[model samples]
Target: MTNAMQLNLTTPGSNLTSYIATANSIPMLTAEEEHALAVDLQENGNLDAARRLILPHLRFVIHVARGYAGYGLQQADLIQEGNIGLMKAVKRFDPSVGVRLVSFAVHWIRAEMHEFILRNWRIVKVATTKAQRKLFFNLRKSKTRLGWFSHEQVQTVANELGVKPETVLEMESRLSGRDVGFDGYQDDDDDSFAYAPAAYLQDVSEEPARVLEAADWSAHNEERLTQAISTLDERSQDILASRWLSEEKTTLHELADKYGISAERIRQLEKAAMQKLRSALMD
Candidate 1:
């Protein structure tokens, strides 16, 4: 089963095949219908119009999302992200642009899907800038020849894409690389010492100085909090203890019952205690 839970705002248990079938079943709208829906959504924020416009084109998003299935991501997630882009495009689409809704939506759909791909494409992001994003898709397409690009070909791509040859080379390098396992162990190979992410990447968590700094920071914050709490009045301190410091926080009504006061009084006391605590902490 395709993981539909990864998607957003789509029907439950809706697979790509099912989504395609449903969307394709809806006839494509004429220019008049498409324009009317776009105007309703863009001018009046008619959610119904938005839904109507989006429903018919959902399959198109799924089709485009299918093309990006090679990135080892959940298909439903890509479709979901594409759906968001489609909705955004629908909201901004100007019917007077002399283009079909599909043409306008295509850019938005691909943009959202591309963002999702780059963010989750690897454990670490491969593309952080517009140029890198362009390189990412183009580089993948360029790799269709089944070998690395020659220096001359790299220069050609660089010139055509209006980027430095080195930038093209760098993006290509990042694209060709795969995520390495941090630990040295591998299930496929018994050789425990070979092909480890730990070997190629440094583990900052292992640094004693950094570890100590984090520990010290946590300890100091705890001490400061204790000092701040001590500065509060007896009633305010007790209120804080009962409301927040306890393992089971006391609700306003519960505290009010204990204090023989209204819930509003308890709330006021709680707010005043928080203000005092904030001031003490700031000092």
Candidate 2:
């Protein structure tokens, strides 16, 4: 396929799933059919024949894009870059090269995707990161050993390298660094890399399942408590409410006065109500 034959088979604003579906709908090309198409395009400059050749292999671009999913960029974007590579492959597909279009297209596909990833990766790591990387390389070359530099050594290195001591320390810190996942947790299913603040721009904490479980447990306990309170007699319920559930708890003497009984009698009633509630809950 020539430049004239590079059709935008993928419609604008199509998502990854729909894009994959559309690519899959195009029938694949056989060796013989591919050879004929190449010859037709080369000899007669047949754009229709070129479209047929290119459209069918869009799925192949997606396949290559899948290999780069670990980079955490948009799959659709990677595939789109790979499509450019595919078009270039189709354009340069020499039948005399004696290889199939797919066999030849692999290089072009990976090159495009890699270039895209590196470009965006630099956007994440352009200014300070780039400088730190350069500093890291230079310092590593100048160092004599693989150990941490002493304070005196750090000053010596800094003065020698014509940079501030803090810059030297910063690069040293970076040398001991590791790149984190762009979206923090590696276990996230959907893409959350779209909104990267300073915290998650590199990586952040994992999922908080324990907090959720605690909340659920609290709600469950509240429900069971309501059910248990429903089983108490009115007097026992009033004693439990006044002595246990009120904002200001009632003393045993106060509860006794309210129930027209001795303090020891109110205590017995309160203890019995607690037992009944506990039994209901345990059931």
Candidate 3:
């Protein structure tokens, strides 16, 4: 069997025979060696000792990272991130606390994996806030079956997590839905895996009556605007042009300078012009 296949056969994260055999052929550390190395790294910041302590834990990080495979990140990359977290935990470890390095590092490992998963969960993240993060991780487990979470099951989870039922339901809906391809290739048939946004999302164009109504309303508004513009004095029209219709609309100060008036006077004129336009449009 290949080395990779052989590696896969062993329990993940615990036995690093493949890595050990490949990297140094060193035996796994005893509890004494492990503690001593952790203490050395923790106290003196010995990077080499830290590397030795963390190398064996690489397999463990891979094991935890594996659980997040559904996120679709490369396993190697996830393991790399988890290894970084493990190294950080080792650096900050308090050996006097009487906890094994593994126990302390597990949080760091999972934290890294969680970050990887969150970042890679979707092209656009499905989770944003802290509660959403919790929901994102727990909602799948919250499911009692493959299809949907029943109301009671949702309530139970909501109570356990101390979140509102509506929040739980919204998250559940998001989880149940999936990302789909926007469009298929040219050769795609009816059975092809395309999900055009036009097909699934609300199509405003589909309602011809609404479309016609919108068009008519827009045309009517334009007519009213033209009529209003016709009614303005030549000076007012010119001021409106430079002030409102230009590529870079003139500021009140600029308009005041041009019209030889205070900025506040310019603002009043602009407001009056807008009010007339509104009245004309309403009519």
Candidate 4:
């Protein structure tokens, strides 16, 4: 905490070349040194030992993150996510596992980067299922041509990926689609608005009947909550209000001092109060 790490993996101002240069400058750890640091952290909780172990392997995270550059996401963001995965792997690493930390950490690093890609690659997500996710990453690399896949090529991809040809075509269609605004262009004069999704797409939420139904449902729930709160005793009511309803919740210790009881007693009372509220709402 005294000072920040000097080995800059990705700073805001640094470009890809600068990041690569900084990463390349860091030295990789030998097997003996890595084992000693891992043992130091595992046995004695030495953070400095952990840092030394982490610093050398940051270049590896950068290397892995580079493989994801075609996704159109920021290079810095990918590396940052990969860095998180590396830290997680380091924390769980066992020195006795008879493998180097980098070997174990690669999976963790890519897993984090994959999550980041799935989250940000498209506005509506190109892949939802497990198989689709695998295909999404591999499909680009599996391509043999620059344009659309031919019928035979489609079948080949389906065979290799263990997915249906239809599924592959559907995913490819989705990948090729671009995100359009729900509302028309920012400066709309009639022509632009006519082409916008909002102009033609059926908005179920905006229907008069749907709006009234939603309002009625919300009001009924509010009434039920009020009735539920009324069922509790005054002390229980105060605890629930201070702990749940108030902007700044009162902690168990704070409530215990106020009620002249132990924190454990407050917790038990709070639990009982919640059960009572649940029962009241059900009725």
Candidate 5:
């Protein structure tokens, strides 16, 4: 009997309306029949019994999927996910549990639908943590009016959902926000395009004008430094170069040895040169 019923069962496909009608047309099983099929699948792993168990519950999956229509996802996709949950529930159904398949399967069905919504609802995921997910589904339903939640409402939702008011507010903000293109839309006018993130959030380092200005400023400072260094006497120039400019910089004692002078005298000369350079550059 189960094999004949399985042969008659048709899975949902691209034609959603037709699939839904077929699902609704399938007969609901009596408690005895449901139990027998569940026992067959659980004990003997009968695929035929599993098919019979799942086929009749397709309408229930459709019913459950309808509640998630506001998530801006395709109805067909949600129904398909719910159908998978129905199959999983059938595979795990225990005949001795003394509960109908629908009751047992509701959790599995909603779980799949919830997962699907979380994945496809937005480009960026809104709810990641367990608490956020709980708040995500329940917060909207908790609202009495349309606009942003008042302090009292936030507190009420937080208390009821066992989360902080701040968390509730954060999720509300996420839900109310919309995804925007960084470059903006193709049909956007000048006014709208000017407001896009790409317009203002720019890399000044990459700008031609800024890059040219930075280069010119650096060149000017280098020119000034060269002139400043030129004002020092030849010996002072050599001392400064040896002490500061050289890659393998000389120590004060090393410069003193080359100059045939005490290290303290070399230090004083180097300091005087640096002071003259500073004064020239400032002028």
Candidate 6:
């Protein structure tokens, strides 16, 4: 509701242990107190009531955030995101539903943390689809021992998660992979820097010698092709041009109609013209 209130509850700048202690020190609300706060907020749009509802629940957010510790994100940031979810739950909470705030808020809290993990976990996203997202979070827990999953283990995980074995394998691969810098790390020494992708990968397209050679070769072929086409009869030349050289190529049927011949005859003429051009270019 207010910066002061959030800082008092989270104290995000402080060390993680201190933040956890502060969150745990906050008193829990009784059902009656929680209900009253929910009613006040829902009826009157009371920010203070919403803040009270959120304070006692910061501990629960910390607990949920701790479960995601293996993801390599900062515990403090995860807790902060979970706190935001708790606040959203507090605002939209319906006491009339006969559910406690924590039970209702768990989904919202985990949702925010999951989003943070997916976004920051990899430079490339590991999960884009709904099934992939489900597998991304659950795959690590499904593995009993590490390294890689055996075919049987993969199938087991797939069945347990209601996904295909291929999906399980793909998500497992993604989870196990680490992001590497394309140009190599800044701290890399001379020998290591030479092995980096930027050092070894060449962009030959931008090389002046290669560029000039390709252009010259293309021009030489074009000159030979023009000379070869000149040796063809007028009809053969026109058909060849319309069929192969024009921007808007003429269809055999169109050529047939124009020349008062059957489409088969047009095809035969085209074939003969191509053979003559090939022979001339060879010479």
Residue pairs in steric clash, candidate 2?
1-90
> Model 2, range 1-283, lDDT digits (tens) per residue?
3443235554314556766776788778888999999999988889778778888888888888888887757787888888888877888889988999989989988977886786567433422455665676678775646377889989988887788999888777756665543433222222443443565343323346767777889999999999889888899989999998899999999887877899999989989999999898899
Candidate 4 colliding pairs: none
TM-score, prediction 1: 0.40
Q: Write the per-residue lDDT of candidate 3 for residues 195-259, one digit (tens) a residue.
A: 56777678777599998999999998788788998887776787788887899887878778887
Q: For this target, which candidate reaches the highest lDDT against the unseen true structure?
A: 6
Is 1 or 5 the stronger prediction by TM-score?
5
In order of lDDT, best first, we have 6, 5, 4, 1, 2, 3
Deviation of model 3 at 135, angstroms: 29
**Candidate No. with top TM-score:** 6
lDDT of 1 at 213: 97
TM agreement with the true structure for every prediction: 0.40, 0.42, 0.37, 0.42, 0.42, 0.43
TM-score of 3: 0.37
Kindly list the per-residue Cα lDDT of model 1 for residues 1-283, writing each as its tens digit: 2233223235414465765665667677888999988888878989878877877788788889889977767788888888888878887888778888998999989978886776575633677766677777777787776368998999888887888999988888888787644443343233554564546678788699999999999999999999998888888899999888899998889888888999999899889889987887888
Candidate 1 vs candidate 2, lDDT winner: 1
Error of 1 at 182 (Å): 23
Model 4 agreement with the true structure over 116-154: per-residue lDDT tens digits: 776575832787666677888778666535367889988
Q: In angstroms, how far off is 35's CA in candidate 3? A: 1.5
Model 6 misplaced regions, further than 4 Å? 1-6, 123-283
Model 5 scores a C-alpha lDDT of 0.81
RMSD of each: 18.1, 16.1, 15.1, 17.9, 16.9, 15.2
Tell me the deviation in Å of residue 148 in model 5. 36
Q: Model 2 segments beyond 4 Å from truth?
A: 1-8, 124-283
